[model samples]
Structures are given as C-alpha cells and as structure tokens.
Target: MSDIFRYIQKYQNRSLKELPFTHVDALIFAQLSYIDYRTIRNIYAKPKLKQIAHLLDLQEVEAGYLSGKDNRRLLLALAHAKRYQNIQLINETKIINEETCEQFHALTFAYKQMYYIVFEGTDTSILGWKEDLHMLVYPVVPAQQDGVRYLEQMLKHPFKKAIVVGHSKGGSIATYASLHVNKKVQRKIKAIYNFDGPALQSVESLEPIQNRYYKFVTQATFFGLFFENEENYRIVKSNERWLLQHNLYTWMIEDTNFIYLDQLDSRFYQINRKARDALLSLTHQERETFIVSLSEIFDDNQITDVAQLTNSWSQTSIMLLRSLTKVEKEKRDAIMKTVGLVVSEMLRR
Candidate 1:
C-alpha cells in the first residue's frame, strides 16, 4: 500500500499554495513533533525544514523513539520536499515529569502566514503508555492541560489563522484546547483535526466548533476506541493488523490525501466496544491501582519500551495476568475479566 513516504516523493515539488494544505500534511507535522530537534546543532536559530535535513543525524533518529519500522524516513522526506522547505518551525515545548508521569510535546510551524500547532502523540517509551493510561482514567491529565496552555501561548504570536492537529493522545489535547480557549481565540482557529485520539468528552460538549472538528481513525484502530467518542470519525485504510493500526505511519496514502474507508471492521468494533465498557466499569481507585500494577509489571519484566509491549501484546497479556493475581478478590474478577478481553483481542490478531 502506498503511504506518506511515497506521497512525499510524489508531491515534493508542490507548494502549499499550489495544492493547499490537507489533514495529511498536518499528520506529517504531528508525527514530526516527536523528533528531538534539540539534538540538532544551533537549534536556537529555529531553522527551516530544508536546513533540518542537512543538520539531522539519521543515526540518532534510528536510535530514538521514532525508530519504528520504516519510520526514520519521515524527516529526510520532509527535509528534501520543496513543498515544506520554507516551512519554519517557530516554537516547540516538550515536558516530561517523572513525578506526575506527564509526557507532553507541542510544536508550532509557520507557513504562508499560518500557524499549525501540533500536540504530539506519546513517544514509544514506557512512560508514553503510562501517560495514555493517565488520560484514560483522569478527568484531565496534566499533559492535556499543558497542551491547552501551550496553545494559548502560541496564539500570542503574530498569525492570521491557526490550525490545530494531533494524533493519539496529542489529538485529544488539540480538541480539548480548542474547546477551552475563549471564543475570541476560537474564532482565530481555522480547523482542528484529531487522528485516532481517545475522547476526553463527547464531541457534543464542544458543539461551538463542531463544524471545524474533523476526526480520523484507522480501520483496525485500538487506541482510538479506548474512551468514549460520541463524534463520528472518518476511517482510513491501514496496511497493519489490528492494534498496530494505531500507528498513523501504517495508514495508506493516495496523492495528497489519506485512503479513506467507509467503516471499521465489525469485529474490531465490537471487541473494543466491549473493552471500553469493561474499563469504564472500574472505579477511579481501581483504575489507579491497575496502573500502578502495570508499572510494577513492566519494571519486573525489564520492559522499557512501549513498542515492545505492543508488538508482543500476547506476551504482555500473560504478564498482566500475573500482575493482577494480588488484586482484592472482589476486584480481581472484574479486572481479570477485563484482562481476559484484552488478551482475547490480541489473540484475535
């Protein structure tokens, strides 16, 4: 399946004014937010995308969180693409607090008198999953609140229009900030694109900007289904299987757009619906305990990477089963049942 890499090669010469910006472009910037540009020389200069390619060390990228299969190509592609050469990265805010287990990254890119604020998805590190779990259970996570604050700060910059986009947990924060920002500021926002992010609340809660809110999910989405999402989302075809579809890099691309699909596979839909129900049944305290248990399990297993856990979910499931053995007998049954459903989902893959 043709994906973003091929899309970049095909459209490297086209300018934003020529073709117009699309969600696909936003998605690229969203994922690029993960790169640690601080590692690049003279980062304080805030170089354009073209300068970035020459300065970036791919060997460093190959060792970092973006090290997923075929993922390292993104920066090189963006650097060489004439369409993005003039795009200027203005500001980047990244916060990682071990005490709160908060991992947040936001990026501001200016192109043709517009600002694109991208709240990044979690890194593939173990703490990334911890933050995702925090979003799932907490009414509002610290990182999400930070995203809102970051957006507000970026708005102070001189820009005629602003667009917000994010994937995974970052997507959740982009929408959250859109809703929280004052109406005066809201009027400045051109659009908000959420890619497979879990919901903080129903879309109806933010009805004022509903028209501009666009949500996208993959055919076999797993993370996107974690929480309640009342808003309808467009589905994109993916080359990966089941939960692996959470990675937007696997999503198919056509020309300048994502390969859209009409509906999700019913099986993935039903299974994740069941999983969400089971998770919601847990009390906040229960959820907290479960998260703590997960941390212990990971530490015990010497698992430092979230991708390692996901890529070997079946083994992770077995580890979870062992972790839950000490839960109160009353909570055990419910939590165990939830674990069973997760394992079953992985087995189905």
Candidate 2:
C-alpha cells in the first residue's frame, strides 16, 4: 500500500518465474522482528536440516541443503541465492582463508532462490514495515567471542561489493570485520549498518572501522548508554514508533520509517564517569593480576562446600599476589573501596 512496500514487492516479485520455490516463505515472512535473532542462530548452528525442517514445519526436502550439520553454511548459501542474479551472500567464517572466500563468492547471486524452507501451515514469522520501506530481518542468536575471532570469519567471506548489516552483537561483529577485513575486501564494502549494537571497549582505537559505519538507536535505549565512548559515532534517526523503542516492540514503521532521538540521560553520563575513573586507577599489571585470580576461582576443583574449605587460599593468593608485590586481598579491598567511591560520585553527579 505504501511506496516502500510497493518497491519491495516489485523487487521481490520480479522474475518470479525464475525464482526458486524455496524462497516463498522467507519472502512472505520477511519483516524484521526481535524474535528472529535466536531462531536463525539455532538454525545456523544445528547440523541437521531435518531438525530445522521440524522446527519450521517444513519438509526436509524443502530446506536448501539436506545436511543441517552446518547451519551457517546453509543460511549463508540461502542468503547468496535469494537476491537478484548478480548479488551474492555468505555467512559465518571465524577465520579467513582462501577456501572461505571462494565458497562465499561461488554462492553469490543465489538470492533468486530460497535460503530457508518453512514447514507447511506454520506461520510464526512476523513482518513489519518501516516508513514505506519493507525490511526482511532474521535475528541471529547472540554469540560471545573472547575477542575478534568472529570478525575474522566474516572478513574472510569474499565479495566484490556488499552491504554489511546486523543487530546488536552482529552489528559489532560487522563493525570489527569491516575494520580488519582484507584490504581487497574492505575496499569492496558498500555500507556498514548496525542497529543498536553495543560499542567495543576499544572503539576509539579503531578509526578505520568508525568512519564507515552507520549506527541506529532508539531514544532512551539503555544500550546506547553502556558503551565506553560514542562521541565519534553517528546515530540513525526514526520517528516515534513503538517498535522503535529500545525493546523493538515499539517500532513504528510504514513506507518511510522514522528514527527518533532522546537526549542522552544524565544518569548514564554519571555511571560512565564512575566506571571510567575506577578503571583508570588500576595499572595494566594490576588488571592482569585481577583477571588471573578470577580465572583461578573459576577453574578451581572443589567438590562440595565442605571440601572447598580444604583448598588453599594461600596457594591462590600466592600466585595472584606474585603478579604484584602488593597483598592480593589488600589490593582487592582498595579496588572495591575505589568502586564504592566511584558509585557515590556518580550518584552525586
């Protein structure tokens, strides 16, 4: 009914005769919703297509690939196949290698077909419009990495020109991959779009990554407030839509979706200042010592509460305190005291 919807329908419906049958459900269910994130992630991680088929209520035959062992590969293959003849899509590569790029590039332009197949008569997928523009999003489940291993995987995916997009953690991964991607591939990226993803702690150091990204946030979304530094970042604006709320349930979308802004809350600034000050007090060596101590606590083998008492605090503290000449507990107490001070100052601010 709206101009954007009309445009999306035209684009989706064009070359229908050439389109593969597998794509019908995805097209019909193409609207973005918060629910899609976990579903798609599980679908990608599971190895058997039959399992996914069961979940989606589609026959195993309908899933693009017979094997579910590699959901990332299957979904990515579908992404590649679903677009027009020339567009290519690839998903999930933690480490870039020659083989990874080739697979991604090979699967390019598969968008005319279905990447995912739905079970018969099961219509759980929800679709919505932003302004007049219709968006198709399948939220991927959150993945936590020690650092940038996931970024490396995406970077390895080969593409001559592409638009990289994601929500939350996916958005952060998109940002990391865009910055550290191979020089050749980096040049090929057309755009980087992130929807309310948390910023990396070290974002300030990533000048190359920062310049090309477009970040969207809902006014008063707690996410925007949790980051280390957003002074260099940009925000995408939207009108007051319910889905546009931080929770995504408040998204107000039509043909021309609007993104709105709320002034950054004072509470967030106060919290940020407290955190920054506390972190600044610790030297790099002290930080490492603290982390090692925490790691030991997690790795210790204590059977029961009673048995755990037998474990030697002396040994743990010795190793921990060895990292610094200062007494381990004393240092910890100081840090806690500093934290309390930080919190008090924040409240005062």
Candidate 3:
C-alpha cells in the first residue's frame, strides 16, 4: 500500500488553488512540525517553505527525530511541491523545562488567510513521556497552556480560518486548545485532525469541538488508546505490526487518503490499557509525587532525554535510588504502592 511519501510525489506539481488543501496535506504539515528546523536555520523570522526546502538536502536525516523513516524524503517533497511552496511557517517553539517537566514544540503554517497549527508529538525524552503521563491526571499541563496561548494569539490575526493538526501528544494538545479557545475562535477552526493521538481523560471534553474534530489511529494502536476515554476514533490499516504502527510512515495510504480499517487490533491494547488504567488510578497527591520523583531522578543525573540516561543506566539507577531516599516519608508509601502496581502489571502481562 502507498504511504504519505508517495502521496507527496503524486501531488507535488498541483497548486492549492487547483486542488484545495486536504486532510492529507494537514497530516503532512503536522508530521513536518517535528523537524528540528534550528539545525538548518535561525527561523525566528518565520521562513517560507522554499527556505526550509532548500536546506533539506544538507540535513542529516538520521539526526532527525523521524530517523529511519520517510519523513525527510516527504519533507523534501513538500519543499518541492507547488501546493505548499507559498506557505510560511510561523510561531515555531521548542521548549524543554526540567523544573516543569515540560517538552513542547509547535509550528504554524500561514497561507491562504488561514493558520494551520501543528503540534509536534513527543520526542525521545523520558520527560516527554512523563508529560504525557501528566495528561492522565492533570486538567492542564504546561504544554497545553502554551498551545492555547499560541492559538489565541494566532487567531487574533487576520486569518479568517484555521485548521489544527497534531500527531501523538500534540494531537491531544491540539484538541485541548481547540476545545478551550473562545467560541469566537472555535468558530474559525475549519477542522481538527488528530493522527493517532492519545485521548483526553474525558471524551465529553470534546463536546465543544466535536463537529470539527477527526481522529485516525492505526489498527494496532496502543498510544492512541492509552488513556480511558471513549473517543470515537477511526481505524486505519498499517503496514507495520503492534507498537510499530504508531509510526506515521507505516500508515498505509491510497490516493491521498489513509486505508481505513473496520476495527482495531485490540490484542496489544488490552493488557497495556490495564497497566495504564492502574497508573491513572493514582490519587491526585500521589500523581504529583509521581511526577516530582521522576523529575528529580532524571534532573539529578544531569540528563534530559532517554538516549542520555540509557547510555549510563548504572549511574542513572544510582541517582534514582539516592533521590528516592530523599522523598518525604508520606510519599514513600505512595511510591511503594505504585511499585506494587507495576509488579502486578508485569506478572499479568
């Protein structure tokens, strides 16, 4: 089956005027937001597509977060595409704060009097994963606040319409911002596409934006189904198996659209959902301790991402143990209870 890279090749010469922007195009830009554009140019000035495209050939593909995938190739295609050449990328931000345990990145494509906001999924940081965990208990995470602020500011501009798109964690954030933005701003959103994004804790939260929202997930989705929300997400066929389906590059596309599936591959989701549900059961105070303990452990090791910590597991483990000892006496019981849940999950799995 074809994928998005092929879709880019098929549509490169077509203009948005000739063929209006489709949901597929939104997905393409959403995926592109993950690029570390700073590696190529200082884009505080909001560069056009041509500028970004010109630098793609020199970009180290492996250095990209979408390593071993067609993201770079697809980006190159987007750069060359007549449809996207007129687009300007703006409001780009990548912030990682150890104190807040926040990892956020977003880019907005401004064109045709519209704002196409793309919230990037998580990077390979343990902290990013922790932020995703924050969604389990947090009514609002730091990144979500940033997303809403960004949305509000952008909407105030002359753009008459908007589309919000995101993958993974960004998808959830995109949904959150779309839901919370004022009624005036919400009316301007043309559509909200979430590609295999995790669910917000309550599906009812989407009531404000339901008519404008769409969610697509791979058949063997775990990330999309991670939290306990009855979101009415559609299923798409994937070329890969199990957790690997989370990779957008593997999602099968045909003629500019995803190959829709009748149902999900629930085998992988069930056991994992149980583990996630258990974690989400933590009391609000326990959840706070959980976040703090993790932040302290990783912060003390002087590391940010998973790659750094994994490279020195022994030292990291030592640091974590030392941090655990400093936890308040009351928190120890909660931590121990969490450990028990994890142990029980392992045995069940």
- Candidate 3 per-residue C-alpha lDDT over 158-244 given as tens digits, one digit per residue, 9 for 90 to 100: 647899999999998898889888888888898998888877776556777888799988887878877747557889888987666
Q: Residues 1-349, candidate 2, lDDT per residue (tens digit)? A: 2322333344453443555322122222221211122344355543232233234423332342212223333333333332332322223222212211111010111232222111111011110011000100111112223113333443354543444554544455456556656666666655565555556545346656556666666543434434546654434333333122343223333433433345544554454455445544565666645544443443453222212322554453444344344425655555455445544543453
**What is the alpha-carbon RMSD of candidate 3 to the true structure?**
4.3
Residue 154 of model 3 has an lDDT of 83
Candidate 3: where is the Cα deviation over 4 Å? 39-44, 308-349
Which candidate wins on TM-score?
Answer: 1
Error of 2 at 294 (Å): 2.1
RMSD of 1: 2.7
- Candidate 1 lDDT, 214-304, residue by residue in tens: 8888887877756655546789999987878887788898877888998888877877776676667767777787788888888888887
What lDDT is reached at residue 271 by model 2?
A: 47
Best by lDDT: 1
Assess each prediction's global lDDT (C-alpha) against the native: 0.79, 0.37, 0.75
C-alpha root-mean-square deviation, candidate 2: 13.8
